[model samples]
Target: MIEAFDLFSVEQVAFGTGRWEQLGGFARRLGSRSLLVTNAGDPGDGGLVDRTLRHLEQSGVAATCFRQRGEPRVEDVERAVAAAREQGCDLVVALGGGSAIDAGKAVAGLLTNGGSVLDYMEVIGQGRKLTRPATPWIAVPTTAGTGAEVTRNAVIGCPEKRFKASLRSELLLPRIALIDPSLAVGVPPHVTACSGMDALCQLIESFTSNRAQPLTDAWALHGIRLAARALPRAVAAGDDVEARTQMALAAVISGVALTNVGLGAVHGFAAPAGANYPIPHGAVCARLLPPVIEANVAALHAEDRDHPGLAKYAEIGRALTGTCDAASDAIEAGIGCLNDLVDQLQIPPLRQFGLTPEGFADLVSLARKASSMRYNPVTLSDAALTEILQKAW
Candidate 1:
């Protein structure tokens, strides 16, 4: 018998070298007025905002732009919703990285739903569901990470609670995901390495997640292979169009996979780490992924009962390492390969980012409450969680 599963995706998606030029047409169909959300970077210095505005304007779409500097916060989304409402914008366009896309998503939802972002957020709020459909949203990703363009949830950092949680709804998925891989050529090497590692972890965790189904497994496997082959090349030579394209494709695939199957321990810890510190989201995932993999493998071995997900790790090992071995042996080889890749990418230790003993303890407590932990392949003990952090440190 086949296991029951469901898949959710954006209404429309376009991927290629010059799809950026088609953003105007997508926007015009959505509405006459648009709100363009972007990072604070100047277009003259290689930003995509100026170009995006020009496209919208040429299509007779009136546009106003909002620039966000860092991760999307609850306050940022609130302010954006008010601004868009006051300006009478009818559509939302996210033109930069994940933060911008998440911010736009929140704005689009709140504009019609009529509530603060906290009202619909998970973990620290009422967790109310969105009753009304969001305004049409167009996601134009300039980075090859996060894959927020096609996701139905937006992560918002809550400063008051010192937690980062997701604001989610099926209605929050964008109307169009306008993906242009060539737009990622300007990303720096360090950023590419960090984000690529995030993509890699997302694929691995989702493939092994307790919620994984046949459909997500296919996407996750394809993403893992693509990321493994492309990440190093992208980091070493940022101008490689082929590598960038593969990583971009992998990132979106990882997003869709994780959305359906969920993630695991790496993201469980990374969310709280980002909330508590000034560290970048991708950096936290890069530092924690290998340790989480090792911990999961060890925990599975220690269990007296056989877990179905245990063999999945070996599959990942064989896929990533290109080796055929017994399940147990392949699992070990996969762990070693992940460790080597993390080191090769120069992902720093958690301690280097000023994570103190007290801070780590707080993070551990927060992670236990994280939504991502529910999908882990194995249930980890507090001691196990501590060991993963200590090893990563």
Candidate 2:
């Protein structure tokens, strides 16, 4: 018998090579004045942002620009919300990488909910529910990773508390996700590698998550296949439009899959690592993914060899290596493939990001409390978690 499951996703998705040109028309339908959230540094030599402003203006929608420098913080969301309110902006257009999109999502939620980020953020805050729908928001991704365009939660860090958490609600889903693969054609190779690895990790984790269901499985598997074929090409050649398009599609599929099934250990560690250290979110995932996979496979082998996740791991291996071998062989190949990818990408180790044995105990404690940990296929002991960290280091 099939199990019952629920799925959530963005209301609309406009994905293609030249879909960005439709942004102005989409915004016109949503609202008149827009809060345009983007990266602090110019993309496409400042032409992208300038063109976006022109598009909105041509479509008769006024815009006020807000540059997001890094990951979204509680204060940053508040400041953006204040700006939106002050400018009477009724629409939000997030255009850039994941950080900017997340910032825009949080601002849109707070604009209508009428409270500080702490009022609804999980773990580090009161964890209250949002009672109202967020303002109409559109996501225009310039990077082919993060898939923040379709996700329903915004990750916000609290520097004072030294933690990061999500301001989560179904209301935060974008009104439309407008993805134009051409926008990502000029992304730096290093950024492409990091983000592509992050997307791959999300797909693998979600596919093997304890909550995995048929719907999410379909999306995850397809995404994993696309990433397996496209990630290396995308990183090696920035101007390869076909590779960029494939990666972009894979990223959106990953976001949809993860939103429904949740993620596993790599993301579990990401929250604590990103909050306490200077590591980028993608870099953390890249550095830790292989070890976490090894740990989980070992735990499953020792205790629950028949776990569905084990077979899923073999499937992932097949996807990555294009091997039609037995389950055990396939799983090993998959793990080996990931290790090779990490070395090829040159993802920095945790130690390079200021992590050490001295702080392992603290990170383990915090990771245990992370929301993503609950979705790990097998419940791991603290010792196992520490070993994973040690291996990654």
- Measured against the true structure, the TM-scores of the candidates, in listed sequence, are 0.97, 0.98
State candidate 2's TM-score: 0.98
Off by over 4 Å in 1: 43-46, 304-306
> What value of lDDT does candidate 2 attain over all alpha carbons?
0.91
TM-score of 1: 0.97
lDDT measured at residue 143 in model 2 versus the true structure, 0 to 100 = 85
Clashes in model 1: which pairs? none
Clashes of each: 0, 0
Would you list the C-alpha lDDT of every candidate in the order shown?
0.87, 0.91
Per-residue CA lDDT of model 2 for 202-304, tens digit only, reads 9999999999999889878888989988989999999999999999999998889888889999999999899999998888998899899999999998887
